[model samples]
Target: MAEETHVLDRPPEGANADWTIPQHWDRYTAEEHATWDTLFARQAKLLPGRASNAWLKGLDVLKLDKPGIPDFEALSDRLMKLTGWQVVAVPGLVPDDVFFDHMANRRFVAGNFIRRPDQLDYLQEPDVFHDVFGHVPMLADPVFADYLAAYGRGGQRALGLDALQYLGRLYWYTVEFGLIAEPEGLRIYGAGIVSSFSESRFALEDPSPNRIAFDMARVMRTEYRIDDFQQNYFVIPSFEELLRQTVETDFAPLYAEMKARADIPVAEIVPGDTVLTHGTQDHARSRAAG
Candidate 1:
């Protein structure tokens, strides 16, 4: 989700009311397809042991291995059959309400463009690779699919309560940068981590960032960094539990409670946290000191 101020009053020219545009898959040049292939090849090599099983399986199920950027129609056809989810192209970021409404109904809106070859390591906005490669795989899992839909519904309600700040945190921590615990170990699932070459390693292997158990209340009150790697990562025990906590809880009171409390500092570990790793914050400090 984007900031409220970035939301335009209406859809820009050529976009639908929902801010969706045709993916225009045929229009992609050979160079753009090559860029997708390069990114895909690297991530494919790196993600097998590092990414969640569900995400890895989704990549196979979606047949993303074929050369060139995927045709959204083909991708959606497979995804819809498995999970009632379809990917739609958007000009770029959409308003929160539009985003929530689409996801609530299981339509995943993705940016239509891919990052340039030179910017492969980082890009300011989420491109098609981040949206499709990073996120769509997890959508193939039934439980994660339900959790996202639930989050979308929750986002709508949060808007009514003027609690989007709280709701957005849940999305940021879980959907974008979340980790999941498998019997083997903690694995990367969040799109932000899985899509990132650097962060995928840093999130699990590096000792500079904290890894903490997922707590809904604590997550809502905590701040996250968008300009750099997260100093903290929240790990869920399982998708089943994640969905259970999200669907069963009512957030109105939670939001009210959070409003009265101070926002948790990004790297601060509070008393009740189930700390998995007490990071040195060495990376953050060096970056700051640089």
Candidate 2:
């Protein structure tokens, strides 16, 4: 199983606050570029036909072909023309507020470093492999681009309403590890799954996790595990629909309602769930039994 890392809701220091403000773009070593290529080559081989059209299309449009670690300045120029979105380098996971603030303003953060080859299967903090390669291409999509920005705007509201947990679930199910139903079959769109080879396969083919419909309230109430493959994977009817429902809906009322309620456990199945595959909990139990 791939390991997980959960970032806090607030910045631990001033570092996360201004990561979007770029400086010193010419500092990468040749070894760093090699690292990006190594990771990129591995994921590329694994994702064909399994990843969404939007993801593949965006990858092509962005010209991820230049090789090595992408130069943010050069990459941002092309991305900015397409969606007004630009990737910024962060040291690691930023405070939740720092993350939200960046997203709210059309800025996408990526870890500035690449993962070591041995850590390729999993790492505690997001690296450039998990950031730029996993996330930037999707920002090129108009619908997903907007949905992310809206989620960022909703972040502060979630904090005030004490509904961050609720909103966080929406993020977990959608942005980080969500799936989309394509006419051909299920496709990968979430950054978390896309970046890792094992989870990419496990998320789609394994019977260990519940594949449920995306419900804003239900996702919020439900808890997620960062340490293992997710117990549940939310499936959207389509990437277009996923973006439409989330970006267009007003979350203020929803947050207010969730604030007074208790969170749902990862194991409970909710009603009205469009259950694609119900898990027996045997996969989860084996871990506990260990």
Give the C-alpha miss distance for residue 73 in model 2, angstroms: 0.8
Q: Model 2 over residues 140-225: C-alpha lDDT tens digits?
A: 99889988998899896676777677788898888889898888899999999998889999889888889888876788778999
Model 1 regions lying over 4 Å from their true place: 1-9
Residue 170 accuracy (lDDT) in model 1 = 91
Question: Scored by CA lDDT, what does every candidate get?
Answer: 0.92, 0.80
Which 10-residue window in model 2 sums to the lowest lDDT? Answer: 1-10
Clashing pairs in 1: none
lDDT for each residue of candidate 1 in 265-286, tens digit (9 for 90 to 100): 9999999999999999999999
**Candidate 2 TM-score to native:** 0.90
In candidate 2, clashing pairs total 2
